[model samples]
Target: MTQAAAYSAARRKLHWGWITPPVLFAAIIAGATIGETRIPVATVLQVLGNNLLGTDYAVGRIDAGIVWDYRVSRAVVAACCGAGLALSGVVLQALLRNALADPYLLGISAGASTGAVAVTVAGVGAGVISLSVGAFAGATLSFLLVAALARAAGGGMGVRGAGVIVLAGIAGSQLFNALTAFVIAKSANAEQARGIMFWLMGNLSGVRWDDVWLAVPAAALGLGACLWHVRSLDAFTFGAGSAASLGVPVRRVQIVLIGLAALVTAAMVSMVGSIGFVGLVVPHAMRFVVGVRHARLVPASALAGAVFLIVSDILSRVLVPGQVLPIGVITALVGAPAFALILVRGRAR
Candidate 1:
């Protein structure tokens, strides 16, 4: 492709990647409201319109108030969580210079899960608010631990040194996982253990709209901060030394960018369960379409991530008979093959 043509392609991919997600998210939410009944798309919109503005339109009617209520909230939760994870992926990959690194690789999700479980099993009111808050606290604490540990192991290398981060993240995540398991196993309540297990697997069902509003500002703050660092991220592609030579404050930018990314990620994980792989896959796929420039890549990844989990969550509804699956499982089932394909293709190139 010509230089102009390549840039045009990148911009087009970014536009399509961004647009396609919201449209797909809307479709999934609409289709899933019917559950196994599979209502038409127009009907879904009509019901949505009715709920929001009372336009007296009906393509279909679900008799269960609880079902639709749970579904709408779940859909919103999944979309926001997916977007957060994708942006975290972009930020972490840029900051660490490791395509293999993910938001959870640093143990943020594990820490959040541990905190949520502690609240759940400690006879604290298992309300959504309590669990979310506890989980957020855990995630932030985990980020600090990782930063401290990574800094101690720095060996005078720049923050973007891939080898140190990969080792540090693996160790940190394993530590938190062990703690989470202990909490679950030691709890005397079977139901609570099962509930904690399910929560760790990730589910967006049964979320309240009020919880949605509480998380909105955090999400915006995280995403906006990442966008502001897009220029630094692009400079990062050339490696820490090169970016420094170009006058980029490499370490300072890494701390700021990754810190913001982790904060948003922790908030999302607190609200939703520890959904995985969205971060690892979505950014990689978007990169294929829109080079490695963070300006285009970050927004495109966010949109793609939103669509991906929404569709995955909807599939979890129908993938089995007379039951629903954790939305996380569906993403792994679907994203694994797609992620593999991307990796294989990249190697072939």
Candidate 2:
């Protein structure tokens, strides 16, 4: 490459990297501003400054509570969920070489739903286990089941095994989903059942500072892990054998990255319920914008995903008068059409 061309490329990367954080910040502020009652942008900024920088802007207590205590935390958690899930999708798609690969398709979300219901409705730990812990355990179980099934079907982490892995994931998801239904039906009362159903469909209504503590760290860790293995992820874009030939420890990378994906997916689902299509849609959409390179793709997807979910959450709050829809509903309503467009565009290419 010519020196000028190299400089131009570096400039482009620098531009994107600089632009993404501001875009994400704007989206979060927008999320904080638009809610059941509209708060002014100035107030939102003041609330942030007061909370983060100890600057008092003479904001009203109610407005401060709404911004810092409620909307800010919700937006932060949504961003974390979006980043984590999108990173999971990126890893799965690159490693499996399957465009449809995502946490939902791999049974992670289903297992989380089952686990959450088990704790909430069935009293799995008799009030000892939190919903997030239960969900994580269930997610881990589902991944193990899918892995075992794939192995039994003569499939391993290779290009040839992608189909088997997907199939096993489908089976595992169905099994856990059925288990979830059974638990709800047998153990839950009418009110409990209603609450579980709402949560399963993705409810961010209860998100608070506590969730932010869990979610932000999980997302940061997932992003760090992905960045650490960027080269291996790029290599796996070709195939497992190709990655191996390139001195990427194929088995170890597969286990570590895939495990990280599962853990991140579970953590998000546990916190936010089973919001879908962020994973399936964001990575592919980002690939179109950022190119196939993981170096660009990973952070790009995370930023896009965070913005996407914040917007989706904003829509969920405002799309209907006096009612907040489940966030999963909003995501699917948007994601399904976007996904179809992606498919049509891919076919055209």
After TM-score superposition, the amount by which residue 95's alpha carbon in candidate 2 deviates from its true location, in angstroms, is 1.4
Best by TM-score: 2
Per-residue lDDT of model 2, residues 155-261, tens digit only: 86555688898999899989998999999999999998898889888999999999999999999999999988888999998888898999999989988888888
Model 1 global lDDT (CA atoms, 0 to 1)? 0.75
- Give the residue spans of candidate 1 off by over 4 A: 1-25, 28-34, 58-68, 123-129, 154-160
- TM-score to true structure, per model: 0.85, 0.94
Tens digits of per-residue lDDT for model 1, 1-349 = 5999779857765776678656855655653565666655565666667787778864434532433566666677677778888888888887777887787787778778777777767544556558667877777777778767878886234555567777777888888888888877887478877776776788776566876785667656767887777778888887788889989998899878776776777677767778888888999999998788777787788777877877887788888968889878988887789889999999998
How much is the lDDT of residue 283 in candidate 2? 96
lDDT of 1 at 45: 63
Give the least accurate 10-residue stretch of model 2, judged by summed lDDT: 8-17
Report clash pairs, candidate 1: none
